[model samples]
Target: MSNQDSEPEIDNSDLEGNSRSQSSFGDAIEDQEDELGSSESGEQKSVTSDSSEDEEQNEIIRTGAMIQQSKGRKINKNERITPPFITKYELARVIGTRALQISKNSPIYVDPKDSIDPITIAEQEFNENKIPFIIRRYLPNGNFEDWELQELERLD
Candidate 1:
């Protein structure tokens, strides 16, 4: 067969059928909106009541009131400096990072042993608490705290 016979047929009837169906669907939607008492202005009515708006405003006001209450409370300079406790995950991360640094020829804070293993050296430094590292703690509420390792020792 020739290339012309091999080519797919372009049917205008299918296109007409689809356009008719889409117009019918649109008309059905317009009829539904009219039955539902939609206005001529075409602006949709608010599904929520005035009470919902009042509740939202009350929530905002309540949060603001809490902030105002907090402002009245006396601030303790000493209490604000309290350090958070270190977690196991943080300890592992610090040790692993330090070990990687040591492997890359970073200066060791602790006495270097005969062994060349970076992990062993890191463990030694951590155990002796000789590494001058800061413990950073993050809370789920986006609050973060940083403290010197000395603070961890003090807390212990």
Candidate 2:
């Protein structure tokens, strides 16, 4: 009458609709073996093999003798460079961050208006293209280029 009554009832009715098929290690083992070549024994092995397979599976082989041959693409140094326009996503991110700063009492680089909304001020600065900032562009080769805001036009 004490412990039984104190226990809360659990409702699993919602979980019935969310039931999923049982997952197996077949996919994981196949993926690992494909990425990492079979052991020195020269026969295909499962995930239950010795610790050597496990260690090899953990290490990523980008350039080595053990590197697995894949039909994937190689790095193209002459890949098309990004256009000289600021992407919409980057513009949104910068404006959102600047708006937050303005809301927190940060001084606006542009003139203030009768209304004190930070988002509005940020939008105004963006529309007038007066935001003195740098647009950092990341290349696929792990190098980055900093572009002046004036030099790059807004895509939208």
Candidate 3:
């Protein structure tokens, strides 16, 4: 094979087009600068140092005011603190964990009575709200609220 076959061909028209595009891009930037009031020294007129400092102070004051307002606000009692009821997934997790503890000879909260099954005893303890466990429900903002097992309404 020849060297020409191995090497990629450069089109002169493509090179000319690229050079024209580059020049046009530079021209567009210059036009934008001109429209934005660029001085003869190529310096753009922006907010003065004193004005910028005043803006920063105003921003800080606004932020402080917002924080103060938030602090002064009282929590509404009508707002649901904990979930209305325990979710099936949460109940399953709690039951599974309690059952495991029971299997490992951990003290059960409720009397097993005739039922010797660990899961059955765990369910009874959960129904009677005998478990002293807190469920940490997390919010989308990474904040979490610890709700006691007794605090949540149980569904049959």
Candidate 4:
């Protein structure tokens, strides 16, 4: 027999295996897509329900008087201090700034005692309330209140 007449048989097992894998991969993707679609629909339904409940509560709140009544009558500005006393942060800033001024040969508010240190002198001046400075405290609403150094309540 001639080589042309006696041709070798081709193996298709590898092709069959590849086809099976491709079909399984496609099935997995379809299943995932179906699961995702169902989950998204469930989430949409839950969101709608939650929003409807919120709308009902909002309608009730809108119908009722939502104005908050003040607990106490407003006091005159001169009657009481808003913060009552200077904060530790404010005290530190004042002392540091005054010490800088003292170091620069600025006029000292109080006489230096045993310690001629600028920081010590600034602390003494602060304690004696001799600094003629206004502490401007600002609120979040762009409003500010100015407190005189002597006007603040002292811890000591």
The 10-residue segment with the lowest total lDDT in model 1:
57-66
Each model's C-alpha lDDT? 0.57, 0.59, 0.61, 0.62
Better of 1 and 4 by TM-score: 4
Task: List TM-scores for all candidates, in order.
Answer: 0.44, 0.46, 0.47, 0.48
Could you tell me how far off, in angstroms, the CA of residue 109 lies in candidate 3 after the best superposition? 1.5
Positional deviation of residue 138's Cα in model 1 after best superposition, in angstroms: 1.6
Q: In model 2, where do residues sit more than 4 Å from their true spots? A: 1-80
Model 3: per-residue Cα lDDT at residue 57: 22
Displacement of residue 71 (Cα, Å) in model 4 is 28
lDDT of 1 by residue, 6-117 (tens): 9998988867655533445546554666766656556776784322333342111011112333234322325444344555566667678779889999888888769789
Candidate 2 per-residue C-alpha lDDT over 1-156 given as tens digits, one digit per residue, 9 for 90 to 100? 898799998899967654443225324555566556645446765665322443432211121122322322332334536567777777776678768878999767788678688888988887887666555454444444445556668765
Candidate 4 lDDT trough over 10 residues, lowest sum: 57-66
Residue 31, candidate 4: alpha-carbon lDDT: 65
Instruction: State the local distance difference test value for candidate 3.
Output: 0.61
> lDDT tens string, model 3, 1-156?
999999998878856555533445546554666756656457755854311333342111010112333224322336435456777777887888778878999887777999989999999998888876655554443334445577678677
